[model samples]
Target: MLNFLKKNAALIWAKKHVQKAEEFKKNAEKNQDELLLSLVDTAKKTLFGRTYDFENIQSVKDFQGKVPVADYEDLKPYVEKVKRGQRDILWIETPEYFAKTSGTTSGSKYIPISKEGMPFQVKGAQSALFHYIAKKNNADFVGGKMIFLQGSPELEEVFGVKTGRLSGIVAHHIPNYLQKNRLPSWETNMIEDWETKVDKIVEETERENMTLISGIPPWLIMYFEKLIEKNGKKIKQIFPNLQLIVTGGVNYEPYRDKMEELLGGKVDIVQTFPASEGFFAFQDDYTKEGLLLLTNHGIFYEFIPLEQYGKPDAQRLTLKDVELNKDYALILTTNSGLWAYSIGDVVRFIDKNPHRILVSGRTKHFTSAFGEHVIAFEVEEAIKSTVEKFPAQITEFHLAPEVNPEEGLPYHEWFIEFEKEPENLDLFKNELDDQLRKRNTYYDDLISGNILQKLHITRLQKNAFQEYAKAQGKLGGQNKIPRLANDRKIADLLKVYKK
Candidate 1:
């Protein structure tokens, strides 16, 4: 009955509003004010109203110069207030549940998750079906079992309570059939859960023919590596009917070559963009260039200039005035009752018609080590291109800056697990240097001077990263080994070899 209601409601809503969006797009310029008024008025009732200062929100939207930029740190007080079940700065009622953790950026940012909020995740996640129906033109997903590598189901109490993050909540709320059968029945539930426990996963996969796989990119890569190691050209021997692989949480390009090599071909892959704050968007079409924004349901969208976050003179943009192709930091006003909350992600509109967007990078994750701003994608590209120059294959790799207080230069130390050691380590390093120089000019400038940006390559014994992750309590059953660490201390935590 619940599923029926969900399907019918989504179908009815989509039919009405999708057409409304199309009609609005047809004469958006003419009906700009009217459309804006209608959207905000509806949003006021649906999202804002009693929780927030609706008049102030309208005033800010109307003023249009800039709004205050607030990170998780800034919102901590209010979020804590919500966690304690108090009337927060926004929400009139206490949130039903609180989202546990943020991603790799900050440790854990607890956010309010209402019953209203969970539906967005459900609807957004279900859009995968819509993607198949609309784009791939396939209706049924009655394939083999799906492996969703995420965080653990059991919540670790910080003080004395059980408040696991979104993953736990998601696990709790999954459809009964899905919950009963689809997941890997190990100790760890998600990628974070599986990180520490690969042997059990390998054993599980050996038994079952996994057709659909889902996880963060790094964990998926790690899982595939384990599969290859155990089976040895036996993936086809075991999972002959393996069809689709869905992944998110990290960038895909860096591991593309490695993943392809492991899979023996391109695994039919789907990338996802999900956050605890909101089910912001998902890849809708086959081209997979950008994700389609979930325009309605529970959230109100707003964009503020990336350059102006926290600055005095920053301008905020509404649905009515977002420009195309420009990078803007995201601020979400949601039914969970977060008003103008900065999710700390940066996205750019790739298309204006259906509001397609590309997630450029996180504002916090970018590295300016030695003043060379290298994003996750940029570093991934550099690593991929660097390895392509070598005849020997790279199994796993991690990058980080070797910061020395006594020394002047900041250099990148690469911890690489290889199938076969390269003949000339110097030559291999030179090739990587050349690739970085060609691909990232900022890196080149930093290295070309008196400061020698040395690439230290540590050849790992077979299954070294896997071993290391296991040793650090980060392997097999849901924990992930860091692919790129910004500093030496963090790198030391994950590195298999020191010198």
Candidate 2:
């Protein structure tokens, strides 16, 4: 009777939310201008608002003209003030907490999370699952445990505000009724050590009926490895009822084959684009190629073309102005007080009707030092192709420019940790080089001109990335090995583990 009631309630919840999501899409399409104007008007009372003269801004053009696109460094002072318990600094009031994320080019970032902004994050997550359920026409998974392999929820107080990982904060706010179906209790989740937490999770969920799993791909892979090691069975064998897998943070293309191999069967995947700043997008339709942008959410977005990213007087465009297939660096002006914030991510719009996007790469995570611009998507595709052709699997990899004046010619240095090493390493390296050349015309041109030499592949010892991440205090949850770097910072660090 209890199980029946729970399942029925879950169905009702999903049904209600699915209708709201549809309504939201319709409303956004019809009233985008009105919504943005309302957002500006609502925020006009805040500190950032007052300083920017939001009260006088009558249109998107005026708002764009008044506010400059800002990176984290530009807003750090305001964030610091909020950290010290200052009120009415950026938002109407101080943030309820801050989410600390490892910055790519910069150091640690503290993103403000206001009370009003919290619901959007929660609703975004819930709507993602609800959309999946509505599309697949199956809510049976809700009756079983859904494990979210995430960070610890135990927050460290920054002045009066509680700050922690965004995932941790979201985990702490999971609806009370759904608590019965969630795995790894609060006590287990609060464990600081990732390895220890994984052990405890394996122990706790080993016998449970785990139907759904959600997390970043690498950490999910780690958990699966541990589970298989303990039980001597594949994931599907262990959890016969397992139905869906949702992943994001990094591109899922590279990890797809490996994950399927471990699961022992085809598992449905739903991708999401969740950041500490806000829950931006989610895979709404299984048939669709890109994630549907959460338009009606509390966040307002702008985009600058990739070519115009660092250039002064670059065009900052709103949703109405974006073109399909062009790469654009994402900018956000949110309810949480991020005014025209450049969040460093680049994306391409695939559809405009419902606003679907494909996350292409990061602003700082590309290589163009030698005029051979290589984005993360291109690199990832090349890696995927190389792995498919060879009998090798990459555990982790990083590519950096080798541009020493003393060296004869500039080249891309690939530092790779392989799970299954190819019998002929030379062939593997050549294949990777050929694949990348085929994909990127600029890189091919440079190689043809002899201005850039062929890629140099350096094989690192097993578990090198894990050791490096541990050393940097960034092992597990959300933190990832940056696949491409413009400089040799990551390459230099990985040099210590060269085989």
Candidate 3:
């Protein structure tokens, strides 16, 4: 009863505010620079001398380029201070919740998320929703049960804290009005609660009349595949109204074809960029090539050239100063208590009016085993192109790095699952390897130097990737087999099922 009330209330509020949100976007775009600067000033006042090293940053004579580049590590001192209950580190007005991010192998980065921080994320989320509404121009369709496959409950002191990283934070801010009947009750929490409630989560989602679903691509893909396997041809028939499918957290271009095949339709996937710090952008319109940066919300954006991150004299430019089509590393200052924070994402301006950006890839999620650095986006594109050339139906794929210890020759081994046997498998592999070399100059250079071998493609029968993921204990919802693994050790772990 409470959930129902929240859903209806949220819908009513949305009906009243959707137009204004659209107007806010247009106005923000028209007066981009002034609004951005004003927001930055507000952030400085709200966070400076409180949550971060504001005086040190403000003291820099050349604020643009003089301030040193910061990774997540740079903020550790401040976070540690906060964790230790030091009153001097921050002056948080109304402390609410902290959002955890998937940290680098070690632990997790718990970012303090406040109520002030939520409005911005809400804006981005709503903007994406408005875009979806505008696409079909069906404002009435917003009234339905939306199920977000996010994190589950975790032990927090005496009670189980219901959350998981970004998904958890998103869940946390699920406007007080939208919590009742409109929201699906099932939680696709991460590995934290998977051991006990995996079957239960599947049962709840399968039972609920879930109209809207949003999650990371790999997880959604795995879930739908599981549904097909479990229910046979009755899968799609069960969730006929499950229309809108929103995803981010990974690149979707390479997996789109496979996902469409599995889901049985071209599901609307609104790509978004949500980090531990804040929600950055969302695809505002269906046809747009890039996502609209939530310029008016929680974040103040800054960009430096990818080549200039480490340089002592690299200029950190604002939105007004960015060059379109050029790759730049994103540095953000957000209302969520993070200042001049480096989110480790690389983006390029795709549209100017609405300030849309294309998230190319992560700065460090790359392979440089052969001196030729192949970023995630490049490898994904290469794999997609290679898969398309084959006449056989490709089910799933993974690219693993192969580095020789003795001779130091490095190359990538491709593992693929296909529906049928290819006519000329060897020739196809050679052509794909040639395509990779031609597309990436670094790979070609490594090939010429005898440092990288020609690509080796191995085709597995259907469900190979799924079985591999299950073996890794990454089955059920929200778990996916990573398309690219950087090291041979991680690669071997991912491919332990190879006979």
Candidate 4:
């Protein structure tokens, strides 16, 4: 009976999702203006629409002129009103659910999630799986159990609106039949305490026929470690059928070596770009070029060049106008309440035909103290290159700028927590510095002029970042270590655990 359900469901879902992808491609090619106009027409009755004069908007240019690009801070006051039972403020109706996200700049944030936008979140994951299975030509992927390592499904009410982590809300909406084939049952997932939940997951999935696993990289590593310890075998030894691993929320390049090492073999990996605002993009192709932007998923997108990100009057480009291979700050007007919202993520387009993008980094996550602007994507690539050059495996890392009156010159400090320590620490540091120099011209110029000293490396104790996150009460479930900080706040915090 289970086999019958799995096979039939996979067939139905794959066919439906392929059609959706094709429609997305067609829309990307031509119907972007139509989609934008339709969204405005649908939202004109809402309070935000009225305030922004969505009724009079005739073209993309008109919409852009009327609505100001905004961050979460700008939307918070209206969200607060929605939380207090206000109706039709941003969307057609008051949101029945809110996704609570750990705001790095602000305090915690409650993003409105309407009924209309819920399917897009589920559809994003489904489309990703559909593309992967179709690419691998393996419909049997549905025959075995899959594990989604996510937050608890249990929810709380905020002024009559259901509220919880975004993943938790998605989990709660999973179809009953699919839930049967998912591991670490609802009870275990609701355990709140991450350490305890991990132990329970190990015990429950130890002997199950697990085929797929999905989560952020760090927590997934912890689970794999626990599995190895408990069963006295690598992941493949226990779950030989395991074929695919899905991850996001951080760069997977740094964790690839350790992950493959623990799994005991090469495995297919899929990267996704999902956030509290909306499900934006996913790895649709096998190649490592970039993620396919979902152009028609009840979300409209705008891009601002990174250079003009915070300017008083920055130019916003629609899909038709955006060029290939330029870093842009992503803005979204979703089916949910968020309008002209700057999602804070930076992306660079790699392909124009299908509109594929590589998530470069965050808008606030860059260093320019010495007039040498370095973004997080460059830092991540440098780390990956340096690790490959050496034999080190980095578990977690943070970068910060160091400037002291006593010291002769300022330099960037890297605090790295290594799973497998490098043989020659000095050589590793030099290689990393060289990789950064090759990647960023501005940084290289600074080094050549001797305006900036050589980069410094500080090896951190194992689990230093985990401990720090725990101390800050953000240990798990979408809370991540910021890869780059403008100042020494994160550096000073992690210095106590330096080796």
> Residue by residue across 352-451, what tens digits does model 3's lDDT show?
7767788876776666666666666666667667667876456666777777634555668877776555689887788777777776787888788777
Residue-level lDDT for 90 in candidate 4: 88
User: Mind giving the per-residue lDDT tens digits that candidate 4 earns over 1-499?
Assistant: 8787777778777767776677667569467778778889888988899999998999888999899999999998889889999888888888868999878678889999999898888888888888887776666657888998779888999889999999999997776767888988889999998888889999999899988899999889889999998888999999998888988887787788889989997578999999888888899875565899988778889999998999988889888888987899999988887888999899999988789999999998888888777999899999999998887888889998887736778899999999988899889988999999998999999989988888888888988988988887778778788898888888898988998
- Assess candidate 1 and give its TM-score to the true structure: 0.77
- Cα distance off (Å), candidate 2, residue 302: 0.4
User: Candidate 2, residues 1-499: lDDT per residue as tens digits?
Assistant: 7777776777787788888777767666446566667778877887778888989999888998898889999998888888888888888778987999887556889999889888888888788888888788777788789897668898899998989999999987898877989998889888988888889999999999999999888888889999999999999999998989988898888887778878997678899999999999999986568998998888888899998998988998878789998889999988788888998899999998778999989988999888877999888889999999988888778999999846689789999988888899999888999999998899999999999888989999987988999889887888887899999988999999999
The regions of model 2 sitting more than 4 angstroms off are: 26-30, 104-107, 405-408
Candidate 1 segments whose C-alpha is farther than 4 A from its true place? 1-53, 59-67, 102-108, 139-141, 154-162, 176-181, 186-198, 302-310, 315-328, 348-350, 392-396, 403-410, 419-428, 448-486, 494-496
In angstroms, how far off is 297's CA in candidate 1?
A: 4.9
Q: Which residue pairs clash in candidate 2? A: none
Model 1 alpha-carbon miss at residue 236, Å: 3.2
lDDT of 3 at 241: 63
TM-score of each: 0.77, 0.95, 0.82, 0.96
Q: lDDT, candidate 3, residue 464?
A: 70
- On the 0 to 100 scale, the lDDT of residue 419 in model 2 is 80
Q: What is the C-alpha lDDT of each candidate?
A: 0.63, 0.87, 0.63, 0.87
Task: Provide the clashing-pair count of each candidate structure.
Answer: 27, 0, 6, 0
Candidate 2 lDDT trough over 10 residues, lowest sum: 27-36
